[model samples]
Target: MLDLVSRPAPWHQPIWQQLTAQQDFAHAYLFSGQPGGGKRRFASAFAAFLMCDAPEHGFACDQCRSCHLRLAGSHPDLLLLEPEEEGKAIRVDAVRQLVDFISQTAQQGGRKVVVLQPAEAMNVNAANALLKSLEEPSAQTYLLLISDQPSRLLPTVRSRCRVQPLGLPAGTEALAWLTEQGGERSREECALLLQMAGGAPLLALTLAQQDALAQREKVVEGIKALLKGQVAPSRLAEQWNAVPIELLLDWFCAWTLDLLKLQQGAVEHATSADMEKVLGYMAQKLEVQRLLAWQDWLLEHRRLFASKANLNRVLFLEKALVQWKNLLQRR
Candidate 1:
């Protein structure tokens, strides 16, 4: 209803065409992709199209009554369901509400659209409650489920919907798009940002805007000082506590992988080019097996952090820093 399909992003254009070309659609559809890959944007556009009174070429006509209501954020037929709080589970009560909403006919006398984002946040009971609706959705009702980690969803829930996986755009396309998004980065800078964001265009733009490269530099310098015994693990952890634990762990994971690559004579593929000398020094001073073990630990902690586990953040960082320091002693 917002005319989102009017000017589609490069990666979403094909998906728009595919959706528009289809006259018939499944009751439930799951759009799955990595974080920052634009799956949610695509799903929102698809939802808009479904609710439009006069959709033209998969895009909503903004002049239509339905489009006006949707643009006003008062579309009676459009419902959005997500976790009430960040990193919290979607309870069965929310799913029960959605069930009741779907039971009613569309107020616009058109399609009723429901969007559930980050579908993995639904608890087991909530997911189970939603299964019946997915299995047998009412006529003229559409469910759009968006998830960055579909594997966390129940098999039965996944099996009931048509799944579509979105992938990252090409380097040139992504860079061009990032530039358009006010990134204003040179080619090398754009490439570095893309690498740091794992090739996700929107995320690369966000990282560039947030000066994440400078943040990573500080993190690398902290790790180097900790490993060299110039800074105590406790002190470093205190300093890094200001940063998000998830981001710090991600940087640590990348740095450890870069050290491993250096040890394996794969310097070209190392993540941090500016910190090559420091990474090389660590590679030479730390045992390869110990570095690999540290890598495993970092990955495990990162997974825990992503899942929002209630762990002691300060102690976690201190233990990781201490382990890293111990790795240097083993040489």
Candidate 2:
């Protein structure tokens, strides 16, 4: 069974209550938020509430037959639409299927709901196909669209729905939630995870579960070794074969930003403790123009990674590292 949230996260409680108390519901909702900020969970919970046969106090009645079906992942009236593969575009055929689903009467004799996540993943053709459903509201049918980057979505598509934004939770609230979900993780570890996640509790938990901290430590150590001439960039790139390229690019981008900030005297302290010294030394040695040029190159490749460009990961990493190290060389 899909692990649907029973209710909104604590940070979303007020908005949940407000939405539940509404007299009229929109036919579609666009839930926009950062990843791990509970936008999907909120959308799922709202879908459940919409389909609940016997909603109690603005929440799903778990005892109802409809709730039972949902719990078993066999809810006939509900559909989930997303890309077949991760990081791939949602095809027009899938949106066509959604259009067909929207036209059909509810099998459960109640509301029909569709949850389409990462809505920005829809290509032009797919998004245009979806627009038809948005233009003509089907009776007792609702569509919940979730996106981490709503700006990437078509303006027409975004304008059609009631846009709901979910912000990152307060630091203390995030820390508390992460602590509770962290299992054996110490408070300090959870705090570090939270920092790494940019105060997104669910993401912090996910990173912890993935042992991302250990992975980060390994990468940092390899960088130190490479800088000290103990390891070649090619060797380091090969060593990091198991690490995700997107994550590596993200870290590099972040480090580049930090280096820029330090060089410009924009901040007195480094935000990343693991690379404080490394970034500090680079900031001192590298010219600002060279660093800016490197940042542009890193960002361009990062965009390519986001677009799922078919470049060799090993070669990319080797090239990235060589350029990174060259930034410190005398002009």
Candidate 3:
């Protein structure tokens, strides 16, 4: 049981406190935010509040039986549902299991809480299944759905619950919070991560400290190698393929956009401190028209990343990388 750190965004104190304060309210809630933005943390804190016999400052007293049970994941009344596999949709079966559990009534004789992390991962059938439960919720049973991609959810589903949208705080605040956690990171790195995380510091730290950042850095290095004509274009594309398919296309676009800026001498909009060398190398080596054309590739890549676009991702990168190298050589 990963205890809610409640940092990066202290939504727990501001939002969850109010939600928990409601003595009589609807059972359904939707926590929408960037991944690691503390939506799930808020939900867990709220869940602990709901089950705790003694709640202090909207937090559960660990001394209470309810808190102990919740910590053990045996809180009979609280069910935390999430996808077992990464990047996989939550199937109807998981929702069905929740339905079945909810139907059994409260076990600890308190409020029944159902938490769905990344609620948007529910496929149509699963969403429908959960919708049925929401349509006619049982007594004392509450539903908390947390998702970063709320717009992808069915309007009906979105409408049925109260939506809590969380965004990232200022970099200074996030850094303060992270420093308190004993983690050391530079402001420039934090700035790059914050923007890359789409304003979510929790997400920034998670992705930055995780393998994703390392992979993206490597991919950027590969791109640099391609520009220098020191690496095979196909090898870099292979590395991109080896990275997470879902996130690769996104960061790839970002990298290209940076390249686009550099080639045009938009150095002020540079992303990293090391951008000077990369930008100078690119500006000296690539034509203006070529950089502009790569932006078009990036636009298409962005589209594929946002859509059901498939395998062409790697092919797209391979083609564009070759074009980038060609254009650089033509210099």
Per-candidate local distance difference test:
0.82, 0.89, 0.72
- Best of the candidates, TM-score: 2
Candidate 3: which stretches are off by over 4 Å?
1-8, 211-217, 237-248, 259-267, 280-320, 326-331
1-331: candidate 2 lDDT, tens digit per residue: 1346568888999999999999889999999998988888898899889989999988998779999898888999999998898899999999999999999989989999999988999999999999999999998999999999999999999999999998988898888888887378888788878877777888888889888888888999999998888999999999998887766887898888999999999986678888899999888999999999999999998999888888889999999999988989988
Per-model TM-score versus the true fold: 0.91, 0.96, 0.81
lDDT of 1 by residue, 1-331 (tens): 2224433457878877987788799999999987777777788778877888888756877779988888788889988898888888889999999999999988878999889977999999999999999988899999999898899999999999999888889878887777677545677777778878878987777777777877777787887777667999989889876677766776677778888888888765467776777777778888888887888888888888878888999899889889977877765
Cα RMSD of predicted structure 2: 1.4
- Better structure of 1 and 2 per TM-score: 2
Pairs in clash, predicted candidate 3: none
Q: Quick one: best lDDT, which candidate?
A: 2
Report the C-alpha displacement of residue 10, candidate 3, in angstroms.
2.5
lDDT of 3 by residue, 130-228 (tens): 888889989988898888889989999999998878665666787666545444666656666666676666777777667565676777688678877
What's model 2's TM-score?
0.96
Model 1 poorest ten-residue lDDT run? 1-10
True lDDT of residue 29, candidate 2: 97
CA RMSD of all predictions: 2.4, 1.4, 3.7
